[model samples]
Target: MEAFTRLDAKIAPLPLANIDTDQIIPKQFLKGVDRKGLARGLFYDFRFDEQGREVPDFVLNRPEYKGAGVLVAGDNFGCGSSREHAPWALMDFGIRCVISTSFADIFYNNCFQNGLLPVVLKAEEIQQLMDEARGGNHVASIDLAAQTVTSPSGAVFHFDIDPTRKDKMLRGLDAIGETLQAKNDIDLYEMKRALSQPWLEEA
Candidate 1:
């Protein structure tokens, strides 16, 4: 997982609501467990036509959003199954942050675990960000340290995040990384247990 202290990048607009997990990466692509190749499968149905050619109508297919790292999306985003692949696909697609009015309970937590910042803002705030995303000269800056999202025109918005999760994200610590941080204490505990129960260890 990578640290998400601050990010200043162009925002890609995905205004459709009720975007479920299947629409995100599709069930076909879920056959593979690896996260690296899931980006090709992100919004698979919407990005491709029956002939397997690129669909020019999808927001992500638009040229301006090609390298977008921040996604401004609609409500109820990530609403379906609890697959971890949803965040994986988003991260693989280079979207470090997803801003929506609301998100699914499971998916929201999944984002933090995967080093993706999922912002839940009010509907009005989301609309403003969506408009800024469409502007040619606009850019959004997300500062995790200050917990603020600022627009190019100087508008600012505050967001709330759990401090524990915030600290983990700032340090680039995932579940595995969290466990590894206690390595020395874990080793000492194991040694003490072995000494206390030598017969158990021999058995």
Candidate 2:
């Protein structure tokens, strides 16, 4: 996972509520476990038409929103099945942060694990950011260390995040990376256990 310290990039406005994981990366695209190539399938249904052409009206397809790194979405974002692929797809598509009024618990946790920042804000604040995202600039600034999101209009909104998760994201530490932080201790414990029970190691 990549470290997420700060981001100042275009914002894609997705104002629809109850956006589930399936709508994020459709099940058919879940053919592989690798995170690569998932970007092509991100928001597949909404980004493409029946004939597989790009949907002109979609926020992501619009020229102004191209290369957007922050997504301002409606309430209940990332709902439904707990597919880790959702965050993978989002990050692969260059979305480093997702701002919404609310998010599903599983999806929220998945975001942190994958180094994607899931930001929760008041309904009015979300609406304001969404409006700014759809405006001329379509850009927002996010500082993970400061726990702040600054909209295009220069309005700064503070968000709350767990300290442990915050530190992990800052250091680019996933579950495996976190565990590896105690490598010396783990190695020493294994060595001591092996010496105490040589037969167990042989088995």
Candidate 3:
């Protein structure tokens, strides 16, 4: 997982509500478990026609929004079944942050683990940002250190994130990286336990 301390990127707007995991990457693309190659399948159904030709109208398919790292989406984003692949696909598709009015609990948690920032703002705030994102000249700035999102129209809004998750993201620490950070203490504990109970160690 990558760190997300601060990001200033073009925010592509996807203003549809109830965007479930299935609509994100689709089940047909779930055949592979690795996260790296999932970007090609992201929004497969919406991005392509039955003949696999690119759809011209989807926000992601538009030339102006290409390479956007931030997403301003509608309410109930990431809803439906709990599949970790949703965030995985998003990250692989170059989306480091998502701003929405609401999100599903499981998907929200998954975003934190995958180092994606899921910002939940009020409905009005979303509409405001949505308008800014629609413009071709706008870029959004998200500062995780300050818990602030600055829209292109010069409006600033505060968002809440778990302190632990924020800290982990700042340090670029995944669960494995976090555990390795306490490697010294773990090594000492193992050594002491082995000496204290040699029979258990052998068993």
Q: For this target, which candidate reaches the highest lDDT against the unseen true structure?
A: 2
What does candidate 3's lDDT look like per residue over 1-203, in tens digits?
68889999888999899999999878888887799989988889989999999999998999889998999999899999898889999999999999998999999988988899999999898899889888756689999999999998879999998899899988888889999989999999999989998888876
Question: Could you give candidate 1's per-residue lDDT for residues 67-108 as a string of tens digits?
Answer: 888888899999999999999999999999999999999999
lDDT of each: 0.90, 0.94, 0.90
TM-score of each: 0.95, 0.98, 0.95
RMSD of each: 1.4, 0.8, 1.3
Give the range of the ten consecutive residues with the poorest summed lDDT in model 3.
129-138
Q: What is the lDDT of residue 121 in candidate 2?
A: 92
Candidate 2 shows a clash count of: 0
User: After TM-score superposition, what is the CA distance of residue 202 in candidate 1 from its true location, in Å?
Assistant: 5.5
- Model 3: what TM-score? 0.95
| TM-score (C-alpha) between model 1 and the true structure | 0.95
Clashes of each: 0, 0, 0
What lDDT does candidate 1 reach at residue 14? Answer: 86
Q: Cα lDDT for residue 177, model 3?
A: 92
